[model samples]
Target: MSAPIQLRPDETFILNVGPQHPATHGVLRVKMQMDGEYIVKSETVLGYVHRMHEKMGENRTYAQFLPNLSRLDYLGALGYTHGHVLAIERAAGIEVPERAEYIRAITVELNRVASHLFWFGAFVMDLGGFSPLMYAIQDREHILDMLEAVTGARLTYCYYRFGGLYNDVDDNFIEAAKRFIPRMRKSLKKYDALVTGNIIFRKRLEGIAPVSAEMCRKYGATGPVARGSGINFDVRKNEPYSVYPEFDFDIPVYHECDSLARYRVRMDEMEQSLRIIEQGLEKLPDGPFMAEKKPKTIKLPVGDYYQAVETARGSFGIRIVSDGDKNAYRLKLRSPTYSNMHLFDEACEGMLIMDALAFMGSLDLVIPEIDR
Candidate 1:
């Protein structure tokens, strides 16, 4: 927690929630001005775990910075890696193989599912429902195992290469993924029963911290945060990348604009991610996973190039300025968590302290992503 701030002579005072508290969710510190149990205003203090990822991109070679992408959002690392690789490929005119596109899409979607599963567990745990955390983690373990079999890492995965994956997945990995879909569907049914339909859970979330469509726009929120407020903007649908256009999937949206709506959006998104994964597997083609003609030293023309990918959290983007060199001249990462977390100050105003915490949880923050 941060040191206490001085307050006026009135009963109103500042309360330091965390730089280390579990409720702040990942090295986040929130200074809340409170009147009794209600919050007057709140400010989020970041930079606790800043790694300067964009600076690393400038110093390292195009290929050397691949691992740094995973470190930003460890839960959905593949999506970050995808954005970085796609940016480099686009800038250098590297043509990725068709099979590699399918593999990238498949692995990224699986990572999305794992990320949402972990979020479901952690969010429920935040709300005082402990058992669902265990159930969610139990199901998430299967995805981790499946991804580990192919990527060789469970958590901070650096699986994708500039024009393909580090290696191609085998038949056994495909079989395991095929089995996982049906099992996960069954688990979702149980989750709906145990958490969604519960009266206590519904009461805690239903009308709390309502976010309007206008608020989302002003704050630059995306993913479930924007979707919950009835915005139909998904990076996958709006700007098609990889093999996502080849697959059919619905972008889940909820008009309620409350915490429940955000929760519902993520829950429904897991199903859509599963659909994409299944279609990618069914349409798997026979070809080399890596491009045969990639140069050893990647040098881009003197220009700016940008690539965007829809990660589990939201729109993740990489913008690179190249000077026809092996390394980037200027690199910037547009992380979704940073934009989403920007809404907290306005959103939490006049809310109960408990409700404010719940609202923060609904935003699905990963602080390192923000601090980066």
Candidate 2:
């Protein structure tokens, strides 16, 4: 690892949180300059799990890179996959059918819920609440079952294709999603009582790590991180990709900007995602799942094209440069986690180490997403 941050001989000392601490979450190392329990400064050291996904994109054919999207953020794999597919489709001038678009949106929103649920459990566990992790996992398992019935993988899903989806979702998938919405609503009520109202939970989070709207802009943060700060920008609502424009859903925002506000934003977002899924199901059209006509050898036009989609974390964008080649001339992934993580060094200053770690958890980072 990089040498621990240097300071005066005895006044401040460096502590390495992880390249493998549970709280650091997924092979991350944070070198903190600590004056006893309080952190004077911190630097997040990344790249332990860098798989060079962007380099893989340049080496692989357009279709070959579809599967790599999942490895970046396994928890919210579909969102990344959706961005990749949409980028390629737009570059190649392929039109996705209405039914396929609805299916993509439904599945992606379900994946978003799953991601947030996982985060809820993990974050609670980090704060020493063990029981809620079990509850969160139990609820998330149902989502996995629903996704597995169609995608054939619980995590690291590679279901979305260039023009549409690899396969069409059936009535069983639709019915299960319909059933899941109400069941999840009940679970949300339980979480509100069990976790949100808990005095200890609030004490730990309520006034900690206050991220301002200006900080969000400076760091290019999006998703709940931005929403919690009262900057109303969601790629789905603001950019309007796929069939999301047809749905009626509100982007939840809280001006508190503390960890609790971030937590509340995610909890409220699960409800909004359910609303999107329900509307998407109701309006799902009857048509081919994939485009009837597509190029045998997929190639982008001689220009650059970009597409952005809102994931469970924040806005994810894919930029592709092409000279009419089957493979990308340059493929760049703009992951939200990388931008969100940028604020950690400045945000952690002057806070206790535990609070700083909790603040890190609130960002909902996926390490591979950043390492990529």
Candidate 3:
């Protein structure tokens, strides 16, 4: 063994911030090199929640692997699942019913809203405020209950299937959705009043951890992280798929490139999702929910295929390679958090520990998604 090297009393020491820390919100651990209350440098340590989701995909049939996507990002499960189904269906050239696309849009947007609500609460709580969590959960439960009424589960839902949805929505689901839009709008206005303008919240965020547009491109960060930095890109708009093209919504972008900017993106995104859900309901056509003559089993072309979707976090993409078989030869999941997290080590350098944590919360990381 080599001789132990000791540092002098004034040297920086390491602080392990998680793997159980509440501020992390998951099993993410930050190896932070600290000097007093400031971080000199940091390294994010992942894999605490790794499930090998890509390997899981390779081991199962396309249909069988569908549910696993949900486990990748628990808060934003539907978007991950949506990208999977879309990848498979697009490569196979399978057609979905018009009605199913509308319902999918409705449910997926609901999921997005639910994910953002939870993030809003958890993020504010990360900065030491707790009441937002209570209110946010209160609203999120309404979404979960509605999704569960049809999908049969709240969190990890496999309600969507290859080529279409497993079931058509009922009258109750539609009416509940109509009621939810206005209720959510009122709640959003309440949140703006309660949290957005608070001097403490603004002080905690405004100029901390500034990410440049060039920095976002360098790290391949997507979703609100890129938008917060004023890079105007969203897969739903930039690369339209499903019924996203039929609906009208704006991509919220802020050039401030700080925690507050990312916060505003998510808050504004909830409103846009509401606009999509409302438009989906208004233009919801009457037809079959699943494509007629679609095969019960899935088999893909010999070449590789890729699909991307704008998840609650950012872009979640799935790439599949096939050998004309029911199972994928290779499966690769491109998670936005994984790309977004790369910038943290460099970004947090010389930041006060509290501001670094707040900056991380602004990233909206889902640890399992990254580890996968």
Candidate 4:
């Protein structure tokens, strides 16, 4: 009555990549059934870093849970912070100061740049290039210094508040950011010359792991992974929030649908983030950083609320169901890497194990985000 989709492999062996290794990125495991070097099928082993982040949100006050957002996608912590803060502010009917919004945009973009720079070095290292990681880390430190000065965090930042920021940015922070931009521009050029143009790097990723636009849509992917496959969707531009509408930047989309295309999307995005940061600094307004009359205790009405933000990996969304309580009746977190990583099981099948690893690197996954 029905035919089998394909013949089963006569012989195959299961292999575990890691719960502790670089190939999976941050406590992730990949289970691959291999027929020689080719993968017969693959399954991603998640929950290695699960922290019950959503449940924590339901138990704590709206303000108390802000710090937990950073722990989800530590590399792009501010992006997750932005979403949660926006959700709480909207629910409680708070008005954020324009200056605070501008500052939020600037810091988040800087964080995005830092996240991409880390990905660039790490992804290349996965493919056997080590020199680039040192350069990338050195450049990334400059960003961390500036962010740490203002947000007081090297990583896992909890800088945003319900109505605004925890504190205002000083002139020194603005000056540091402005000076940092041109220097970063030079660094991006160097990265392109050293990594992007290298023949070996090109050969490794140029046509490896080609994920199509339709496949990206089917899998509900976003950020560079989807953009690499020719899908042009970004929450910042598609659905403008905060001060993003005032800034000018273009979404980087590549039709190549290969590992190289994903790599290029992130590289180009760092440049776009710099553009957003530069514009934000120029248009910096003089106003209070926090709402003068921020509610001392936020208690949302009985309803369901949702907010979305474009993180370094992809779109991170927060949903809350409240029954007129200080603590949410139910809280849900939608992390982009979760959706992006799910596609790996299907995409890696029938490909060489080495190539499958290359494809996984292309995803730019941060496993804690998925595990959450």
Best by lDDT: 3
What lDDT would each prediction earn against the true structure?
A: 0.91, 0.92, 0.93, 0.91
Better of 1 and 4 by lDDT: 1
lDDT of 4: 0.91
Residue-by-residue lDDT tens digits, candidate 4, 206-235: 888888788888889988899998989999
Over 4 Å off in model 1, which ranges? 1-10
Q: Candidate 2: what lDDT?
A: 0.92
Model 3 Cα lDDT, one tens digit per residue, 1-372: 997887677899899999899888899999998998889889888899888888888899999998899999999898999999999889999998999889998999999999999999999999888999999999999999999998988999999988799999999999999999999999999999999999999999999899999999999999999999999999999999998989879999999999999999999999999999999989999989888878778889799899999999999888899999999999999999999999999999999999999999999988888998
At residue 14, candidate 4 shows an lDDT of: 93
Query: What's the count of clashing pairs in each model shown?
Result: 0, 0, 1, 0
State, as a TM-score between 0 and 1, how close model 4 is to the true structure. 0.96
Tens-digit per-residue lDDT, 183-221, candidate 1: 999999999989999898888899999989998898889
Q: Determine which window of 10 residues in candidate 3 has minimal summed lDDT.
A: 3-12
What RMSD value applies to candidate 4? 4.8
lDDT of 2 by residue, 1-372 (tens): 998876665698889999999997799999998998999988889999999899999999988998999999989999999999999888888998888899999999999999999999999998989998899999999999999989999998999887778898889988888999999999999999999999988888999999999999999999999999999999998889899899999999999999999999999999999999999988889888988888888988899999999999999999999988898999999999999999989988999888988898899988999998
Q: List the residue pairs that clash in candidate 4.
A: none
